[model samples]
Target chain A: MTTQQLYEQIQQKQSFLCIGLDTDMNRIPEHLLQTEDPIFEFNKAIIDATHDLAVSYKPNTAFYEAHGLKGWHSLEKTINYLNQKHPEVFTIADAKRGDIGNTSAMYAKAFLQDMSFDSVTVAPYMGKDSVSPFLAVKNKFTILLALTSNEGAFDFQTQQVGNEELYKKVIKTSQTWESSENLMYVVGATKAEFFKEIREITPHSFLLVPGVGAQGGSLQDVCKYGMNDKVGLLVNSSRGIIYASQGEDFAPAARAAAQKLQQQMAKLLHV
Target chain B: MTTQQLYEQIQQKQSFLCIGLDTDMNRIPEHLLQTEDPIFEFNKAIIDATHDLAVSYKPNTAFYEAHGLKGWHSLEKTINYLNQKHPEVFTIADAKRGDIGNTSAMYAKAFLQDMSFDSVTVAPYMGKDSVSPFLAVKNKFTILLALTSNEGAFDFQTQQVGNEELYKKVIKTSQTWESSENLMYVVGATKAEFFKEIREITPHSFLLVPGVGAQGGSLQDVCKYGMNDKVGLLVNSSRGIIYASQGEDFAPAARAAAQKLQQQMAKLLHV
Candidate 1:
């Protein structure tokens, strides 16, 4: 939703942990597969298990999409469940959708209106028109890709053309767009060292920090440089949480993982 | 499909036209809307009407995604129809998907493997890990967003830091990545002047060119500077082709629009 709303949740819960629901079909417990909609069942259990501990549930759309129509249905059901069960928990459709102006508007409508996700991750490569449509929707924030966590991120994202890195330029230029107030950015937790510089460019914008946990990013290091006065960080851990176990204890183990992160987030926010 | 296969088809048809199936619910004929799945019905009609005129059919995923589960089903049906009825026609899932390595791999599977689309549109902002995953798939190409046609495309794409534009740098650097041979690029037709420069960077790769009609891009200019020895252009016309008529004659009108582009393409090819 809005940064103000997210800030309140972080303050109230004393947590900024956004549990990632990157659910893999083969990785999910075998028992759940017997259900009519296994992915939805798994997501529901994870949401139910870890909702209170997590300020947000970031469902990377790619995971659900791998299963085809069933995957999309699971995504819809998960979002609907979140709205019905845990209204306070911010929902981020980690879709990374960006296109032409008219298309982006329809995309904004699909995730924000039709599916009812609080936010959708967007790519800034197509520039202002691709990203602006998402921001135009009231209460829906556009989490633009700034600095990602993948190793290949260094390939183009960190390339120096003249003086500044490309990612920095993207952030600075994006700030000039209409409804820039609603824009957040995706700054990977693995690139925690860049947080200080990233903050300089986007001081107030909430950072959707992915690539922690299974991706070997240190939470302590991320919090050290990424945290703002408003607890402006949504450190996401996907596989490390959801795939904690291969048995029926999977959901509970997921809850434990999320709880551990939430406890750490609480301590981080204490300062 | 590979560039060679795509090239052979273009040669066979003597056309560079790639009819875009941007089928919208509101725009579909009223009679088709009465069907259980209007999107599939509309796509089937258009495909039936214009299969011979076009070498490729690029379905902008947003149109299907807007309708939710039914939309996705329609997409699957349309792709299946293309495979069964017109196997020679190249199929593209115009789903601009890019993410981290693992996530991107799944997205590749979703479109290229599971869904059986030949190629997908991807954003290059996330760099190599994001794109390489899509390229890794056999018989599938990753069409990276290079220079787009939209108004906001200039916002970051054309922004100069020191010497080269960001998009130019992206094109220059991405050539070194793994399986780059499978990479195509999106160069909007509206940016016709930049075609020569783009050709210098990516000479052999196929270009999925959008903005041919409704976006006010000139087909003549696109062919002049953008065409290569390989006839390497998949010039897309979405609204101009699909929404040619809102009435029951929509399918036949779509064929007519496709024929007009095919005629121009044939003349450009000197066929």
Candidate 2:
């Protein structure tokens, strides 16, 4: 999906909410286990109920990968289902993958092309060659990890590279790469104040902001600093939205959690 | 497998050569595509031929993942086959996976615990929490990416963070994490001079050195600085060994290539 198309979806839905499909097998409702693919079933239900409220769905590959072959199969089904059912909704494969040049191309093919995700999250540790492959894939977005929400973000990301922090350096250096126009960034919403500096680096590129729900970042703070004129902020809420309830009404509950965030976003967007 | 067991195997085999199973379908022989599972079939042939020469097999996950479900299944079969048939040979799932704490735990479980790799490569961009979970896995090595072989390594890795380079800070900070004893690292053999500084920081920790054959790094230079008393280096050569012959003689040809590297390692060890 193009950035303009994504923005149109946000306007149409009056929301920039990206519901995270971090479907944990143990955390899902127990009755779903009786189904053929519990993970897929849960994901499908959540996507079905909440697709209208959210502009995008970010599925973390690690959650599915935890189950091995069956898990990978579930991931396959989830992506296929999304493409088939809700092609308009932006799909982000939150697979933090990066490697050497050739290997990185394989990963780009795996997630962006084969899996048919609109975008895939990439680690920037390996630098230009490792990440450029993903950018090379036309019409697909490479959401490079900049300032992660995790406590571990402080380890090296916040450290000084020269005069600036490493994440700032990452954002600045990434723009100089080939086809960097396809580049978006993963900036933690928890670091709302830093969003101002980040936006200054790349004013127009969309930022996939995580840490809005369970991880605890104020929506207003993120929007106040991070939101572009096009509302280029996909504030993701995973655990807080998906695991809202473990009862039979889990899907509706998921929708309710998502609705709450979407309502707040709608208000912010003045829609 | 324990670090001592890995060292013992290296001593017994007189080699620390890690054969990288970066099995690209396009690069593999045409005849193998006729087989039901060409990736697995090719991997089986290569493993059966050169298992004795190479102390470890580092299967880059990108190759399998590119094929989607079938690719994942091939990966599953390949790892299972290695565990069942060649248990003594140290296995490295060159997945380069690291996420937030919980997600990283899932990845650690996926590769180290469930997939049953002796070790799994992890990216350190996310920092301490993202990596410590991999270390928490008992008897499994978490090979952290310290300095990579690719040209992009100069982008952020070689950049000065404080008094030392970012890779050095990574190596230093990593040693302070919990279960740091199980932590090994990836230092590219391409930069052999950097190996001395890496070894200074991680004296006993095994370094999974890539960029040896296809990418061109001298074995002699790597050992001169990187090797410890236990011969702590798993020098990986992927394309040079695996793609030696794309004909029916591929297996034997792979064996020859591995034998050449093993012989060099043996000479280095004075075996």
Candidate 3:
């Protein structure tokens, strides 16, 4: 999906919420285990319940990959379901993947071409060639990791790089690469204060914020500092919404959590 | 495999060679594509031919992932084949993966527990929580990206971070994580001079060195600065060795390429 299209979706829904499908089989309702694919079934219901409230859905590949082939199949099914049912909603394959030039091209093909995700999160440690292949794919977004929500984000991301922070250099230098206009970034909601510094560098680019709800990032702080004219922010909530209630009413419960966030986002947007 | 077991294999074979199984189906011999599983077949032939010469085999996951589900199946078969036939040979899943705490644990389980790789390369962009779970696994290694070989490495890695370079900070910071002993690092061969600084911080840890032949880094230069008493380097050669020929002679050609590197490594080891 194009940036304009994503922005439009936010306007239409009054929410820039990106619900994370970090589904764990063990954490889901006990009844769902009887199904053919429990993970897919759970995701299907959640997507059905909260599709309108959330503008995007990000399925972190690690959750699926942990289950091996069966998990991968669930991921394939989940993305396929989303594309068929709600083409208007953006999809993100939050697989933090990046490699050498040729290898990265294969990754770009795997997530962006074969499975058809609108964006795939990429790590910038390998620099240009590793990330360029993903950016090279037309109409697809390469959401590069900047300041992640995890405790590990401080290890290197916030360190001084010449005059600016390392992540600032990441945002600045990546802009010069080919087709960088298609680029977006993953900036953790936990570091809401950093959003001011981040916006000074790339004011127009969209930021995928992942720390809200469970990770203790306030939605209001993120919007207060990170928002742009286009409402350029995708606030993601995973465990907080999806696992709100593990009973058979899991889907409706998820909708409730998402609706609360959507209401908050609407107020922030004055929609 | 433990670091000691890897050092022993290098000593027993008189080579610290890591042949990358970057097998591309389109690039393999035409005759092989007629088989039930061309990728697995190609990898089997290459591994069988060069098992004695090379101490480790690094199958870059990106190559297999690009092929989709069938590609993932091929990867499963390839790793299973390595574990069964050549149990002595160390395996590295060159999948540069990292994420949040729980998500990273799932990734650790995928590569280390389910797939049974001795090591998996991880990007350090996410920091301690992203890396700690990988280290938590018993006898497994987490090879963190330090100084990559690509031109993009200079983009963020070489930049100053307070008193040290970003890559240097990466090395130092990761050392304080949970199982620092289980940690190895990816210090690309192209930046051989950086090894002097890297070794100062990580004197005993194994370093997986890529970019020897195909990417144009001198084996001699890498060995001169990077080697410890254990010959702490797994110098990988992918295209220069794996895709040595496009005909039925591919297996033998791969063996010959691996053998040539083994000879140079043997000389370096004074064996």
Best model number under lDDT: 2
Clashing pairs in 2: none
Provide C-alpha RMSD values for all models, in order: 1.5, 0.9, 1.1
Q: For residues B175-264, what per-residue lDDT tens digits would candidate 2 score against the true structure?
A: 999999988899998999999888888899999999997788999999999989988889999999999999999999999999999999
Task: List model 1 lDDT by residue over B234-270, tens digit each.
Answer: 9988889888898889988888989988988889997
lDDT by residue for model 1 (A48-156), tens:
8887788899899999889889889989999999999999988999999999888888889899899989999999888887888898998888889988989878877
Winner on lDDT between 2 and 3 is: 2
**lDDT comparison, 1 vs 2, better candidate:** 2
- How well does candidate 3 score on lDDT at residue B81? 96
Top-down DockQ ranking: 2, 3, 1
DockQ scores for all predicted structures: 0.74, 0.92, 0.86
Off by over 4 Å in 2: none
What is candidate 2's lDDT per residue for A14-43, written digit by digit as tens?
Answer: 999998898899898999999999999999
**C-alpha lDDT of residue B146 in model 3:** 91
Quote the lDDT for B146 in model 2.
90
Displacement of residue B227 (Cα, Å) in model 2 is 1.0
| Model 1 residue A214 distance off true place after TM-score fit, in angstroms | 1.9
DockQ of 2: 0.92
Pairs in clash, predicted candidate 1: none
